[model samples]
Target: GYIVTHVDRATKYLMAQKIESKTAEAFNKATLSMFMPLAPSKRLTLTLDNGKEFSLFNKIENRLKIDIYFADPYCSWQRGTNENTNGLIRRYFPKKTDFSTITDNELQKVVHKINSRPRKSLDYQTPKEAFSLENMSGALGT
Candidate 1:
């Protein structure tokens, strides 16, 4: 499974999705699905690390019509937001744990817990509160 975060630059609202995949193809599909529900203006750009796992960026960009950028090798600071979130996730699933044992339902629960937790950057607002469908629609003037 992969964790994808979509940040709306204008409002600083973020939508995060946990996607389950068995292969690179499935990963790309899951990534696209996560972005499909958002407003076009909010889906401006995607920045990902140069991991082999993200080699399918072409598919994601083509399907979503969003630009994709890659961070330089060894430049983890460039993707600090995502790197920090990944660290938070590691608290739940450590690096050595076999992800193959995790079920889809269990994965959703993990995603739920992460989203519901308060974020200091968001002034103690949980991501669920800050980036709810209702809030996004309102922010977009929909």
Candidate 2:
């Protein structure tokens, strides 16, 4: 069992979901479900961790109609946003916490809190705000 996390590089918006297994089919299903609600334009590119669970990257690309790139192995900086997101998740559920015991409702609550919280990097605009197309132009990171 594993918890999958995805963070938007530009806005640092985070999406998290739990799967009962680490199998490729399970991984793909969880990942795709998360992106399904987002418009194709908002999810044009996905840079994923170099995990074997992502062996279905080709299928994901075809289904989402998006380019999929794998981050280089051993380089955390390449997926820094996701790494930071992992830490944020850990704050609520410590390292030894079991994903199986967590409920989808509980996970969604944490995701909501994180997205609604402001970040200095985004000029105090929450990721939810920065993620909206109308607020995409302004940036404190640059």
Candidate 3:
């Protein structure tokens, strides 16, 4: 299982989903599909860790038409946004818990909570507020 989060840089909005999968290819497909409604453009650059779980990067790049960048091995700080998101997810799903027990609906609730929470980085704006469709669409047009 893997968790995916997409942040709209211009509006600072975040969309996250937890995927149930045993392989990297499945994760990539699920992530791409979830992000399609956002109208992804070349501005989408994914930065990921060098975990073996991300071996399907080529497939993801080809399918989504988005470039993927890898962080330096052993340097988690390079992907701080993801690292922070993983930490937040831990509140609901602690390490060592069986992910198979979590349902898609339960995972969606968790994603909602995270996106609705205010963040200091976004000037105390919830990701939902900062990255609402209205805000993002307006910014993209300008």
TM-score of each candidate structure, all chains considered together: 0.77, 0.90, 0.81
Model 1 worst lDDT run, 10 consecutive residues: 6-15
Runs in model 2 deviating more than 4 A are 134-142
| Tens digit of per-residue lDDT, candidate 3, span 23-114 | 68666777677656656542467777777768988887787677788989989887666677778888999998777788879888888888
> Comparing 2 and 3 by lDDT, which wins?
2
For every model in order, what is the number of clashing pairs? Answer: 0, 0, 0
Which candidate number has the best lDDT?
2
Error of 1 at 80 (Å): 0.9
Local distance difference test, candidate 3: 0.70
- Candidate 2 local lDDT, 1-142, one digit each (tens): 4798888877888888999998889889998998888766667778877778889889989998888888888998988888888899889999989889999999999999999999999999998888874334542220
lDDT of 1 by residue, 41-112 (tens): 656678877777688889888887788898899998977766666676678889986666777676667767
- Name the candidate, 1 or 2, with the larger lDDT value: 2
Clashes of 1: 0
Candidate 2, pairs of clashing residues: none
